[model samples]
Target: MDMGNRDTIGRRILIVGGTTEARELAGLLVDAGYEVITSLAGRTDTPRFPAGIVRIGGFGGKEGLARYIRENCIDLLVDATHPFAAQISANCVAAAADADVPLIRLERPAWKKPEGATWIEVGTAQDAADALPRGARVLLTVGRQELGPFLAYTGCHYTARMIEVPAGLPDDWRVIAARGPFTLEDELHLMQERGITHLVTKNSGGTQVAGKLEAAVQLSIPIIVIKRPRLPKANAVDSVVWAHQSVTRIFRTG
Candidate 1:
């Protein structure tokens, strides 16, 4: 039986992931009958997985990841890390070249202005904080790293949201310990429960936390969206569905 154009080589792929796109990609690869393994940074408290061979934690460094590549016979490498994760992306670039592996990056697109959504742009975390009104109840969707800057902004109450809360968040901060892919009803309720008048988030383009955005618009709360850096030069996809199509295009060598 002729298996027309199908490569005899079953792809041995390693996905470096710590984001929503990574999880979704891993699941899709498994269903596609590809030999896949996923690596997580283990940064979140309870990261939800989409099912496949999962490895939690780092690869030590480029040398370490290269070793794993050679040892496991990794044929393709996909870096689907967060936009802020410059270090990992650099390492992946170097290691893949050294190991002689083909690499692709799954970069989610940054947010664009939408009608009815008023976005105030800011360069830094402090700049975003300065744009907010004093003593106003704010829904802070900007992760934990940047929240410390706003700690000294007096009188303003905050509903600080993170995958996990740190030990030292200011007493004035009201912490919400939860992960995202959040629902509109949930975000709306949070806004209502806390009397939130402002929303602060990065221009992270995915629709996971977009519920809060809708809630902000409906309530007439201003949104402060910190812009993301330019994407590193590499093959990229903006969403899970598009990423699936990308892999489907990988040519099969007889």
Candidate 2:
């Protein structure tokens, strides 16, 4: 991937990024002298930015995104969003096709159930809530946006963790505001201190927040894992390096 002397100087790329892979890819492309633009969903109050042009908020929908691609003369489109962000990812696929731009999806793999772990896998957030036992003290690692389904489960107590505090939470539910890469020890301490009986989270993969899975196994806590939503088919890669190479090859061949 010798991007140094390539004809990427005038090539413009658009990255629909929010995950860590997106930031790394943006930096790599920017360093390679490609004109890069990264778009964020604006869901987070303070988001980590990459080393290139950054745009916050959505482009309406698939139609709006295609319009943006055409209007901006984008040569390549990359979607490096969260795995659970199905709607946006689907939109990216449709928009790229509509705009006739080469699209690449940098989606990280989902987490697998650990050995000796009691994982009740479900398709949706509501299913997870329904699968929980009555009067359970649950530790919720699912994002704030996905907390709606659990609200109806008045029989359980929830300790929800997220980067930002979402509004309209129940009075009895506890909230922890923090970011991840939490160590196993930290997870163990949190679960023990809170007396967590069950763990609820999405199988978002990546090592950044995987400590909870190991901790749950060690603590013998039943985990209600929400399966990832089905996304539109696209040219998807699982790693940043692969995505970078794909982008380079597309630029060279196109």
Candidate 3:
């Protein structure tokens, strides 16, 4: 798609991505005739690939990532990773600083509690588990990787929502194997059918699966929200469109 425009071509960008915003930003970069490479953390069994060139797996750590940035001639680094992926984001901040590469974050804003929803905000999954009341019928949508701390709360029965169910789940827990963009009707029905009294979820904000929050509000169900981690200071934007504009400005000025 390179149109032979000097301003739009030959610039190399690396997007540390795994979220919807990352995928959308990658497509925008490719359409603008820039060389784009997207990196996934490889935690998921089958991750969805973005529009442009894709690379899976970790870069070892900060030093290895810095070396990669040096070797690849990357002009910019865009971190559009998940809000809960604090370690990777921290590494990116360190690596970019070490390699002297400019970095920008395309982070989506956290969800606010809708009116009528009883929300209990906590700092982490462990804190959420601790705050959960005894014998509550819980809907756990915080993903399988963060289930360890919740497992200690045997008093509550959990209904986990995941892309794939894990083997040997606790006797008190069950899985609803699903992916999102769930309708409010579907979410409400699921909550009713499961008799879920409480929900435990991360505040990874986006429109994709926000129906659950709305459903919780409608049903008078309480939600335990794990707050996003405090990331290292960096240049950041909340929307993909603005991030695209920023990229174009960088290329034009260079």
Clashes of each: 0, 0, 0
Winner of 1 and 3 under TM-score: 3
Candidate 2 lDDT, 1-254, residue by residue in tens: 22233244568889998889999999999898888889999999889999888999999999999999888888899999999989999999999999999999998988998999998999999999999889999999899888888897799989999999978899999899999889999999999999999999998988899999999999999999999999989999999999999999998898
Best by TM-score: 2
lDDT of 3 by residue, 1-254 (tens): 33222233568899999898999999988987888889998877878898888889899998888888887878899999998888889989999999998899989989998998899999988999999889899999998889888887788888999887778897767788888889999999999999999989999998889999999999999999999999999889999999999888877887
Q: After superposition, how far is residue 174 of candidate 3 from its true place, in Å?
A: 1.5
TM-score of each model, in listed order: 0.87, 0.95, 0.94
Model 1, 29-60: lDDT tens digits are 88888767889888876877756677899888
* Model 2: colliding residue pairs: none
Supply the TM-score for candidate 3. Answer: 0.94
Descending-lDDT candidate ranking: 2, 3, 1
Task: Report lDDT (Cα) of residue 238, candidate 1.
Answer: 75
Whole-model Cα lDDT of every candidate shown, in order: 0.81, 0.91, 0.89
lDDT score for candidate 1 against the true structure: 0.81
